[model samples]
Target: MGKIFTVLLVIVGFVYAKPEIVIEDPWVRAVPPTAKNTALFMVIKNVGDDPDTLIGVKTDISKMVSIHKTVNQNGVMKMVHVDKLTIPPNSKVELKPGGFHIMIMGLKRGLKIGENVKFTLIFEKSGRIILEAPVKMK
Candidate 1:
């Protein structure tokens, strides 16, 4: 009976397990009026034991929002679309310039500095996280 009880406890714990995600320093890049695209940068930290994957992003500022990564191909830098970005348990992933970032394309208007933009980040395990990121330069 003791063994069975222990197994039940383990099962219960597994059922309740979830990823604790924290977003820090989230900001959108300021763009000119003629610019049609921009990017969002932030630090994604997972404090829980379970890992989570960032699968998609939704924003009203643009119709096209997707994950992208900067890569060097034959000594030339380029940005490539990525389907997902995984954040490991107890670790943090920094989305900065020249690295992983969220590409906001088809901008409806220029993103001015100090303007806040709402974004819904979809995670595989953590679900949708809504945040307002301020627009900044660099």
Candidate 2:
């Protein structure tokens, strides 16, 4: 009977777990101090059964925040602004340096390396997810 109870508890814990949306290997590359634009990269994992969409992003370090994707158009790299990014159920979405990234424009000040930058990511079904991604010279 005790063994059965333990199994049940484990299953319940996994099922009710607040969807794991980890910002894996989050880092910001080194840029000129006078640079007006910078990008952030990370991988978001969704362990829940329901899908979640990153509708918007908010940060205090920059005046403009937008979801952007870099695509190859006629052998030329082009960056396009997007409204929302989607993450399927039990799947992972990668936002790398040269791929889908968060564009932060009009910096209030140069982001110092080792300083933590907080961002609130609004999702469709998961509500809001907050992440503290540190600035790294990567």
10 residues in a row with least lDDT, candidate 1 = 10-19
Give lDDT: candidate 2, residue 81: 88
- Tens digit per residue, CA lDDT, model 2, 1-138: 999999999899767755556558777655789998998889988887666788988899889899999998999999998899888778999998778999988889988888888888888777787888888887
Candidate 1 clashing pairs, residues 3+ apart or interchain: none
- Candidate 2 stretches greater than 4 Å from native: 1-20
Q: Rate the local accuracy (lDDT) of all candidates.
A: 0.94, 0.84
Q: List the residue pairs that clash in candidate 2.
A: none
What would the per-residue lDDT of candidate 1 be over residues 27-135, giving only the tens digit for each residue?
Answer: 9999888999999999999999889999999999987999999988999999998999999989999999899999999998787799899999999998999999999
Query: What's model 2's TM-score?
Result: 0.82
Clashing residue pairs in all predictions, respectively, total: 0, 0
